[model samples]
Target chain A: MSSTTVDDRSTTVTPPKTRGAGRLKDGRQRSPVAMVVMLLLVLLWITPTLGLLVTSFRTRDAAATSGWWEALWAGGWTTTNYSRVIEQADLGTAFLNGILVAVPATIIPIMFAAFAAYAFTFMDFKGKDVLFIVIVAVMVVPIQAAFQPLLDVLGPRGLGISGQYLAVWLLHTGFGMPLCIYILRNYMSSLPFSIVESARIDGCSNFQIFWKLIAPMSMPAIAAFATLQFLWVWNDLLIAKLFLTNDNTTVIVKLQQLLGTQGQGAELLTAGAFISIVLPMIVFFVLQNFLVRGMTSGAVKG
Target chain B: MTYSHSTPPVGGETAVDESDPRVDDASPEATVPSDYGLQPVKLLIGVLGVAATLWVMMNLFLAFAYHPEWFFDSKILMGTLGLVVGVGGAAVLFWFINVAIEALPRKLEHGLVPYAFLIPGFSLMALTLFYPTIQSIHYSFANRDSTEYVGLQNYRELFSEGAFWSAVLNNVLWIAIVPAVTVALGVVVAVLADKLSASSEKWAKSFIFMPMAISFVAASAIWLTTIYAYQPPGAAQTGALNAIVQQFGGTPQSWLSIDTARLNSLLLMVILVWLQTGFAMVLLSSAIKGVPEDTIEAARIDGASEWQIFWQVIIPQILGTIITVFITVVILVLKVFDIVYVLTNGRDNTNVIANMFFNEMFARGQAGRATAIVVILLIAVIPILIFQVKQFREQEATR
Candidate 1:
């Protein structure tokens, strides 16, 4: 929360008898050059996104005929691409499916993880160290490795739970639980143990203790994980392709479908891409403070 | 026992003694321990009671079933059983353990509570992850069809194949180029954005971070439309780059098709760099922000130039974060598939290990070779994993 501003005039200042005299001389000399360089850097970073935005607005012919910068002078833009994308792609259904999968996927793991994290941090039991390590080690295994095995389980021979929302939801929860537990456990362990002991002595059951005490305290971490998991599931394409079929496809999958083999009608792609990006942007903005807090909190000392 | 003191009204404040046996005791005989045998006997009875109830319910359904076919079908039986037993059973067991943990005496609770919570997660992880990983290793040594024993043959073929070597080399190029470029660009952008004024800073950071939100498939689609062949001659190019070229009176060219000695493949790498730059930027930006302002001011006061301050003061302080970002990017680049799969379908020298695995498994129907590729990729990642673990420990110690 603290902002540390460097002295701008430090370059022109010589060492003085006092710290105040030294800071005063440096504060005056360095501000202008810093401002100019910062402005240039900002411009460089903004150019590409500006180009993408401008190209999305202009007609295909005008876009191809001139640089995105030229669109400023040409002054012709339309929403035809957006309309075409909406009409051609099943954007609505895909977006709904994305929400259906992402919301539960985010919530379930956080729920399971919080309880497990509490137990790991506060409770003592046999084989606790080995169990915790096993969970942590699962993080190293790539999702691709599990794809076949998961399909085998979901397919006809095993659970026979193919092509349903539950399949993808379970897969996401399973994959997400390890890191969620790891972060939540670390955070929960750092809380004051005296409070927990007092609650136990007051005859509070474990579930009651978790629901009333631990959950309220870990809201910041839970919110942080929710933002991350939501973004990941929303942008995910492979798992959706693998598990969800036809009407169950997510927005990202729908965007992929919009682009033909040669990407011929793909000027529509820019609009579709933007549509898919909108929700995540909103989520990030809404939870921006918690997101920053969680990152710093959960960077896990490592 | 004959005479008692007047009792306080209900809800009146009363101090309870810490070692009061008569009030706190659960046993009929307050001085004696309850029979320990009764505990396990009750647990056994509860478990059997639930199992018996499930059995009777299943039989009754079968006996008077409207959907008799469902009961007869093995698949249905197995599915129902798996759901009830696998997921539901786990939930039940978790609940039982949670209850038992609370019942433990205060002195023993600390030692038993964590294990009770961990049992379910560990069991599921073992069943789904650890078991499969071991299965994969076993599968690696088997024959292509996995029908017969063929020890070392797959490993031999893996080492000798030209395509395998090409995939390895491409992976090397990817590891070298993607992470290095992404980190460098990310650092530059992060530093620049940090220097910007408030309004411009938001706009710049948002622009750089935009690609991070796009799916790999969507981003690839965007690039494919923009850079690949979409020219219709007199109609003008829809791709922004080729359009710019045409405006300058140069002929429009398919940038992705330019196989001027693997330049096309490198162009594919560019899309990845663009997509990942935001990730690197965000991490490094925070790292840069964490640099102590006093250090920079002190350097400037000591006659250090702007370049000198950046190189000496800022970079050194953030080197650990830079390494973290670098390793993350490397892992991503190693698993690079979606872009190559979507953009060019691994043509024009763009194929990496992952795409090759997918091609062999799904496209070519060579499960043996596909599994082989996966095993090789896993092995390659091991050294990186070890390094990451070491870094993690070091960081933990400092914290």
Candidate 2:
């Protein structure tokens, strides 16, 4: 009833106004002050990243002698900056480890959340609302709380899952669940009631309706969810560093390790950090559309 | 947060039925499965599911228990096989149980089905989140090894110490400064960027939003180069801030280590503000676009200037989004671990709650004190969480 009331109220205010004026975007106003202000903001925002990017390619002497902007005009670049980190700094191994941890970490949450979402949407289960509410609120539980107990439980004492890929994967799944299930259920439940009603009227079982009817329909949401989760797990350093404590874990964690032990030769950090950064940059561009879906869908990945 | 699409992209996500294609009147898959019969078949399905689930969970357990050797001690091999078997095996397990639950007799199916679907997810949260969370609380009240019950001594000790108080003070400074400044910058940038010509607007926003996608550790490295890389006297300053400082005949004080002016904590806050502003921008930019067209036009028609229109019309409409962005950043600020750990390891009086938690547990082996820090972090998070949940529910009701 609230939904219907909201819908009815919106229709009354839209049509007459739209008929008189074109959409707001069609009307354009440009001001030089606004443009300059925007440019300044953009510059301020991107200065650190741009400076780092240029420094990543510069040789040690060039980087040390001048700032990145100055070095750009002063001319000196090397391909070895990239390869040296990969070959010598063990970034290549770290990169592979990132992929290894990220792939399964990404998949586990999406699948578990999907099946559970199907139940939440289509099945007539008691305590469903309460359960969903509790789980959704679990999104805010500082996973920092989980670390010590998790370490103790899994730390060769209880389950012996610490430092393994499985440890990270399972932890990621748990961390990802509240938001993933919330997004997925919201997406799935929006399917036309007519299709589901017809399926039920024809006596299709709940699982049949979920698999044959709901799963395919939910692919876009799944893809959107997966892309965000993959990036979250990939770029995450804290959780991976804790769980995958071994030398070969994630590129970002390894990059931090590089920063720690190899504090000298600061130019190496620029290249090593970029090596860790490049893949996520690609993912951001490739799955660009889903990110909008991800944001409004819920769970802002920080 | 980095990925705000080119268009003024918001609002379509909340309303999901907008483009639903109508199904044909009679679909073929809907035609079968009227009768609930074959008791033997049902029993077989249930038994198979239970056995297979145990097998799958067992494999997962053994895989972790004997890791580095489970797949012949190779990372690549372990990664590949773990994905295949984990995914394939989980799929089979989920499918079997889903079927087994559906085939149960009418009397118990309704009660059991929800729990069946819920068991894996619930148990995971219980195992990984709730169980650990409870243990953390218990450990907070216990001694270093957690073998001795120290009661409130850890909390008393934590409450009394100046180092702990400084961490709290720095965190307070962070939450106070970072959210307000980041939100103001985001709002201003969003409004200004919204005024840009279509061709370059996205690029301008993308440039600002770039840091959101990178890891904080990498951001630390970048910021170290940009602002914090300190050199001894007579050394050429490579850091941008120091280079500029030297240009004006000032010194390149180690910006990260100096507490003379509380510069180090403020510098750390700037890194957060830098990382978070883009997220705030993208979300607030979309929320700006979502402001009704007629409202701003009406303000302009009423002889309002650009600034008046922005403040009067746009800000009111998107205040909810600003609050949402603010709370999100607050939560992030509370969990501020990676940056502090990577850059200074909370040295020079730059510690926050999360960094303190790590310092106590892993670095110092003080479980009770560590859990207290964690509990402190959780207490800080709860009010903001309640606000977020209320926001979500209100949004849902409108849908």
Candidate 3:
């Protein structure tokens, strides 16, 4: 309901008004002062990342001798940083490990949450509202509270699955499910009741209706959760570093190790930072619309 | 269709007419008679089948995990098998349960299907989150090894320790500064970017949002190397901040180590702010955009200045978003760990609760004290969780 309300408000007000009449200011009186301030702030916002990207491409001597902006014109570029970090620092293995962790971690929770969300949305069960509310409340519980016992359970004395990818995957799934279900249920309940009523009247089983109708209809929310989950798992450091083996960890953990231990590997560190960010960057840009939709759908009401 | 024909209506009012048999009608009153107790038997078989399959699925994965030598030769094989057993196994388990549920009578099937969908997810939460959370609180009452009960000793020791209080102080400082600054900056950027031409607005927002994609570790490394890198007072400073400071004839200080007035902690908070501002901006910007045009126009007609219109008109409308973004960031700040861990390693008196918990548990092997630290975090979070749930309920109620 809020999603549709937001869309209605934006559609009515956004395009025609923003063209010449500033929403905050009077008609067509464009403030050069505002423009200047925005430019300066945008520059400040982008400088650190831009500088790092430049440094990642420059030769070590060139990077040390001059600032990234200066090195831009001076022209000392190389790919050895990327090549060496991948080969010698074993970021290649870490890259593979990141995928290994992120893919399953993202998929498993989405699968489970999709089913739960469907039940919460369509099925008439006792305590359904209370159960949904509890799950929503669990979203704020910090992951730190579970770490010690989870470590014990997954460690050598219990499941003996610590230092394995399974450990991090399970931790991520458990932590990620509440938010996934929350977002998906919010999106699903907003759909019209007629479609589901019609499908049920035709004698479709709950699973048939869910798998064929609801799941397919919920792609935007699913994409949003998938992107968010993939980014979280890939970028995660504490969980991966704790649960994964040293030789087999995600790229972010590898980058942190390179940063901490080898201060001299500035080139490697810069390149590795970019290497770690590349996938999430791609996901963010490609699913940028869904990401924004997902974020606001849960937070902002009409 | 045939099953719907076997309806035995309870109470004559629910009886179906023999003249018009709409077999496809799926109303609740159309209950089928039990074929001499076979329906309950079928339900029993379905329940056992689901339970047994789920049990087998867990043991199968655990069995594979016990022997790494089976696929240890190839990392690819190991990872693929992990996905298969973990993800593929879940898919198979859910499918098996669905089929089993379908075998039951219609009434039993309807009642059980929701549980079939809910059991896997809630069971995961029960195991991973609920059980562990309770265990953590239980361990807080135990000794260092968590093997012996020590009552409130862990709490007493943690309260008495200066390091624990310092971590709490630093956490409070973080909570005080990060969310407020982030929301303020986000609002400014959102409003300003919204004023720009459409294309430039996209580029400007993207630049601000780009940092959100970078991991905290990478962002911290970037900040440490590019923005905060220090050279002793001079000699061609490499860091942007130090370089600018030298340009203004100031000394190049070790920015991260400066604890005088907790400047180092403030510096680490900047990294989180940098990473999260985009999130605040995107959400707030949309909320601002959603503010109706008539309100601003009316304010202007009433001779309100631009600033007045912004505060009195736009701000109140988007207050919901501001609170949402603020609380979201507050939760993140409360759990702040990776940046502090990667940057200072909690050195220079910059420790927070999460990092302190990590050291107490893994680095020092004091499980009781570590869980006590987590209990403190949980206590701090409870009020916020209650407020958030209440807010969500209000929203749903309005819907």
The best candidate by DockQ is: 3
The TM-score of predicted model 3 comes to 0.90
* lDDT of each residue in A1-302, candidate 2, tens digit only: 13335445655755654533322232344557778888887788778878888988898888877777787577678767888778767787888889988998888777778878877876666777678768767777788988889988878877787887888888888888877888888898788766766665555555677779888999988887888788889989888877786665788887887778744657788988888788888887777667657766774432
Which is the leading candidate under TM-score?
A: 3
Off by over 4 Å in 3: A1-29, A73-76, A299-302, B1-52, B84-88
In the range A47-156, model 1's lDDT, one tens digit per residue, is 55555566677776676565556678876687887777777787776777788778777776676677788877776556666666555445555666665556556766
Q: For candidate 3, write residues B189-252 as lDDT tens digits.
A: 9998777755567878888888878899999988987899877764777789888999999988
Candidate 1, TM-score vs. the true structure?
0.79
DockQ for each of the predicted structures, in order? Answer: 0.23, 0.35, 0.46
Candidate number of the best lDDT: 3
How close to the true structure is residue B82 of candidate 2, measured as C-alpha lDDT?
A: 72
lDDT of 3 at B306: 93
Sort the candidates on DockQ, descending order. Answer: 3, 2, 1
Chain A TM-score values for every predicted structure, listed in order: 0.85, 0.87, 0.87
Note the Cα lDDT for every prediction shown.
0.66, 0.77, 0.82
Model 1 per-residue lDDT tens digits across residues B1-399:
011112223333345433433435555432223212124434555456545554653343333222435557333343344334433444445455555553444334445556556655655455556665666666667765456667777778878887778777777888989999999988988877666544455667766666666678767766665455357555556566777777788887767667676677788888889877877887888899899889999999999998999999999999988887887788778878878777766676667888887777656755556667777777877777677566655655674
CAPRI grade of model 2: acceptable
Preferred candidate (TM-score higher): 1 or 2 = 2
Better of 2 and 3 by DockQ: 3
